[model samples]
Target: MTYLLEYSDYGSAGLLIPAGLVLIHLCALLSAFHSLQHVRTSQAAVAWVVGLVTLPYLALPLYWVFARNRFEGYREAIRDIGKEHDQSVTSIRRELFSEPCNQPRTFQSPLAQVATVMGTPVSQGNKYRLLIDGIAFFDTMLWQIQSAKRYVYASFYIIRDDQIGKRFADALIERANAGVTVRLLYDEVGCIRLSNRYLRRLTEAGVDVHSFNTRQGWVNRFQVNFRNHRKMIVVDGRVSIVGGLNVGDEYLGAIPSMSPWRDTSVQIEGSLTRKVQAVFAGDYYWAARADLPEADWQRKTDCGTTDSNDPSLQEEPSGLGAVCTTGPADERPRTSMMFSAAIGAAKERLWISTPYLVPDDAMIVALAMAKARGVDVRLLIPSVADLWAVYLAGFYYERKLAEIGVPVFRFTNGMLHQKCVLVDDSLTLIGSTNFDNRSLHLNFEVMVAIEDRAFICEVEKMLDRDFANAKRSNGSNRPLRPWFARAGTALARLFSPVL
Candidate 1:
């Protein structure tokens, strides 16, 4: 009553003033629904609500106005939402990052036959193998590209035109000239530093190329933030490759930029490669000019390999390496759910490697809980992060995780960009999705989950190398700063959700 009276006395405002606040609140509620209705599941919708309620009263909006308003990804969308007159920061900004955009055909449908021949696992016949470091991974990729007979589909968040990229491009062009259908997709923002002429050369060489959601205009700028971060390759519908590796010398450790880029990737055979192709084809159609036929092609060979006596192969498990894509197009991308499942299923240890470290609160809590359960949870991050604010946020979590007994390691080499999470000695997750709020809820991303023990073992081997080189962040290594740094960090934290 005192507050009401004070408001009334200050400006002689009438009862109608409260109605205005009520109206604004109502509008916020409605806008939140419209923003999140298209998401895949109820949990995502709930998250939208939670963010709307929690952020508007905080300083996040003011922080976002300065930080993300100028980013190429959010400019157009921000403008559109602002024009709505009642849009909140959360409603206007949060973007879902999941794999639903590349919806696959049913497992047992007629499409399964063609998809199976293309390396998509069908029913009970998937096989997966992991390649740990850039050396082995690069060699394997080169061998496969050289052996291609039909078509090649490749996509990556970053495709540098350095030694490794040039090598891959050369092999791809060589195969394209040999009558193989070659298509390549790269993220515009991820490749922003490279010259436009760089990709034009690929086009000139007859390799069909497209960029994911890239455009330059006043109205289409929202698409820029929705990057395709997946690194994948499907060869001739019989084999597929995916994980954290990108086409760069850093990834191969051939360039001196970083001491060694530690990463994980997998080779899959059986029917699952078709699913990868299906997702890639969706991206190709949406971003490129060509329209390939989606007709169900019968499998030319059985995806299952029952014989263990082949000279080039040995006995393995009977499970087909299923391709799982997570992105925003689904009712819920459920990438977080997939991670949760992997973390929960961990037996011995959980090893993670990521360039970025700003995860949502739930993810942090999940990690803490895992540590509490006696799971050996380790995180490998860059000692010198590209962005200082993001680096501080990483430091913020260091104290908490360390207290919980989760060991954190900082790579002594240059910046690490690969994002990977491995559990026990087998299960692994590799793709474009980061453990940050932006990648979890806003960006369009994809990842592949593998359960093969051999693949996990390879990932462990590579992780061991990274673990050795990483320097521990003792809570007291860097001197504590003055008030302004803490204030700046606080401000950054306000907009961390969008950052």
Candidate 2:
């Protein structure tokens, strides 16, 4: 044949071409295998069909690399067994009591209007308490956990086995041991350093613990990016806590590393608690055993009733009341949309505090437009951030904001992990929704849109306290070695999407 004659004309042609092809094919196969392993099972199935139809030669190599190479033999066997023995179960007759959420009288609660505008009925009549600071938030939350009589359900992005976390775990265990159902869920990646032995102790003590997006075998390596970043605590179906604060020494400012962990959370009582329960339940389905039993966790509680002028509804009126939560699993959570509405509705001033501020395109546009409309926009960030990559990525926005009359300040004392937004001395949003792309689109996060003047004023006071110590940045405040720094900053900004 002509091709056979051409191959014969070259020296070592038989050896080189096939060898090179095999090597390149192996490399591509392995890379594709590893990438596919990181994806979900459903995604892997689709990828399998594509590879089989278009590149049949790659099918076996891809499958072997993805399914066999990454996991230990023993863990693989255990995970296979678990896939069959998942023991969660729920009865169809289980009474899941939940009332509709409070209606947004104004634009303060952004999502409240979405259903209404679509001709759907948005429930109204829930009560809310706009809580501030870690101590006030956690103390109130722990009290409710201790008081939980029927069942306790909670989850967080981060959970340390420290004092605050220990107290919470102990309370849940106590209730669980007393025949009150207790279930805890946390993100595996976020709490990677957290000891399973410690968690095992809680389990032995009676608490049911689960990790979100976690697997025991090779597939575990692939699911590291997706996390349940939402912080929530639903107690006895009557009360719930959701907000920015997580279970850590840093969150409590009790650890030496974080001397003053400034944060916010909200405790909800009334119709809103049921909505939070739904959010928690949906997450439980994804993270825990899908067959887990659902009981009628809802109960009647006299504290913090949904009365606009109730004396107990007043801040800390011998109780706690508020709401904060969002997640990608939910339908149209729209964290960014809620934030935009809050910013747009600002009548007097807008103040924001966050550890990271890598705003996405929409958030950047919203802030700029708010400034154009004459809102006094301000931002507070840590002077020395734990994550410099994100810090630098967010720095360029300071210059851009200053050009448009929006002031940005960096705190010098400690890491400012508090995620806060205060608007018009009337509306405030406090929770885990950072001004970043991950929070807006990827991570499960929570925030409360409060229309209470008292709470907003308190948030403004906190901002004022932070501003006094922060180093203000303006057009003329560029550092001395400006060009090199600017170049480095620009490079960082280019990769900001993933930071």
Candidate 3:
């Protein structure tokens, strides 16, 4: 009787263990269903549903880490803020640039679609200078900050607490101490390694500093996928800088292994600078919950009038440009639309350079169509990767694209960090946006579209030099990839919706 009783207890305990596991798996399936309803893409939703049903223990944790897409409360906050000051802001901006011929001619056909998507009208009477590398870019930027007379607004995705970071901070501090009304914004996730001491020093010197806090509300406590990836600096409402360079020693090419980091930036002066400043103002309000007082929000009485024969106006045609800013807060996917339109408009050639090349279905289709129609499509990606998983995943796409006659090249000189596109020989798009899902659907990004012939020629020459040094791939040259690496890439691709 005692032996039978002990056997009964063992059986009951074993049954309980199975029951608990069943319950846990049931919960995971329910979460997966929720994801299917909320995920941005059908591919991601189906992947999550299958993974959760088959491998709950592994998929559940990853889903929680990177599956969330909607930036909770951010869209509502932006709407509310705009409602509070929409008329005043719009009227003030109009009055500030109230001059004849300030409005650029509406772009025809496909480019017009991009203008509508961006919601910022193309402006005339703006000048631009392309900065090729980090050293020249930073030198010009620092000098402009030092020369600020009224105010300065600067934002970067990553601001490390290193040598270059200190130099940037010191420059801002000096301007702030001299009563320049300096404001700085950095991404909390991108600058995760930044020390509190570094920020405290800036605050002590009277420079207002804040992080682009995507985790500000309770509902967003676990939402770490969204990022502010824009790099912009506007000084005195007259000069602005925008591009891919971030604040760090790596950007300066100080690390020997990754030395000669290739990048691009642009400095702009004229009416378009105000538009950039306006974009900064919106982001600043989201970060600090306060308006930048020195921003030129009122009308100017001395706005320049159009004079075609004027020496100043005839000297150059670099003033034809538009600013496009997009993020998760937008009602639609503006960044993706912008890229698609640019690709569709390409008549002769489309050259692109980015560190990452993980394209979604829409972008892939766009590129394929461009190639089918005889658009000379070429892509430049880094031969050596800083992230192993990303590197492996890119191989899949590179092979697929090359099969369609889209020539892809790997930069053997060093890391190609420039996010730029040359559409034919008439337009150039440059900014912090990358050709990946993260930039397309989950980050705050800014891009400038320029249609100046002279500027495009200059950018073309620069890209030609880069292409001469890169190695062209025929798509059949991939080395033997291990089974484990192949598996890792397949898994990594499952998370590309948020990567």
Instruction: Say which candidate scores most in lDDT.
Output: 3
Q: Over the stretch 327-425, how does candidate 3's per-residue lDDT look in tens digits?
A: 887777888888998898888999999888889989999999999999999999888777676777787788778777787899988878999999987
- Which segments of candidate 3 are over 4 A away from where they belong? 1-30, 54-58, 82-113, 298-318, 477-488
Off by over 4 Å in 1: 1-127, 214-221, 254-257, 294-320, 403-405, 474-491
Q: State which candidate has the highest TM-score.
A: 3
The stretch of ten residues in a row with the least summed lDDT in candidate 2 is 89-98
Question: By the lDDT metric, which is better: model 2 or model 3?
Answer: 3
**Range of the 10 consecutive residues with the lowest summed lDDT in candidate 3:** 298-307
Instruction: Order candidates by lDDT, high to low.
Output: 3, 2, 1
- At residue 468, candidate 1 shows an lDDT of 83
lDDT of 2: 0.64
Give each model a TM-score: 0.69, 0.71, 0.87
